[model samples]
Target: MADKSLNKTELVAKIAASTGQSQATVDAVLGGLFDALAESVGSGTKVSIPGWLSVERTSRAARTGRNPQTGATIQIPAGHSVKVSAGSKLKAAAK
Candidate 1:
């Protein structure tokens, strides 16, 4: 069985071989897909790919925190984070 870890190059090669498409074409398509996903998620839009994954921008409120090394108190500014969740199909595939 193939290893579970697949980087971009390996994934593109596999997809190209399976679809009988050129590696360049597959790479381009993947690039465009990533670009679109980032653009949407960065703009506070929820992106959902059925049976695959979902991504969204999440906001966190400002809060106080402690410095472990110095044991000092600090303020953590509010910030945004990206949340990615795997869909049902992905979960099943893992098993």
Candidate 2:
């Protein structure tokens, strides 16, 4: 069976109706939430939206990597990665 889904337009419409706000306002709010999450992750801070998801920064150790095109060994510098973990409620809903 196909999974049920709602597109951004539908989601914004529903949120606008429920919150008594315009669709533009709903879009702005959603955009703000994503912007905040991104800013938090960029600053190496964890961001959690209750009943939704959590975003955190993780480090990758420096290692040797191979160049696919040239087949040459290369050194990769350690860096930070953004990790996202879904909330328990979201996991339950997926089932």
Candidate 3:
């Protein structure tokens, strides 16, 4: 089997063809959606598309860590991360 990963451009083209929209218009809409998602997540807001996916910001506390190369101990600082979870619909689609 060949690798069939879909990139942004291909995704845009596919959506455009399916929706009867111009590729440029589809790409712009996708871009806007991504921008909105980023803005919400950056502001610590959770975003959920029911039966599709969910994205949220997560917090990590500071802790101790190790330097693999030197085997030395180091301090790990607290930080935030984005978590994405696939919903039922997405999981079902993969099967």
Q: Each candidate: how many clashes?
A: 0, 0, 0
Candidate 2 structure quality by residue, lDDT tens digits, 1-95: 55798988899999999999999999999899879988889999998878988999999999999999999999999999999999989989979
**By TM-score, highest first, what's the ranking?**
3, 1, 2
Per-residue lDDT tens digits for candidate 3, residues 72-92, read: 999999999999999999989
TM per candidate comes to: 0.91, 0.80, 0.95
Stretches of candidate 2 off by over 4 Å are 1-10
Two-way TM-score contest, 1 vs 3, winner: 3
Worst 10 residues of 1 by lDDT: 1-10
| CA lDDT of each prediction against the hidden true structure | 0.97, 0.93, 0.96
The candidate with the higher TM-score, 2 or 3, is 3
Tens-digit lDDT string for candidate 1 (7-58): 9999999999999999999999999999999899989999998999999999
**For model 3, the run of ten residues with the poorest summed lDDT:** 1-10
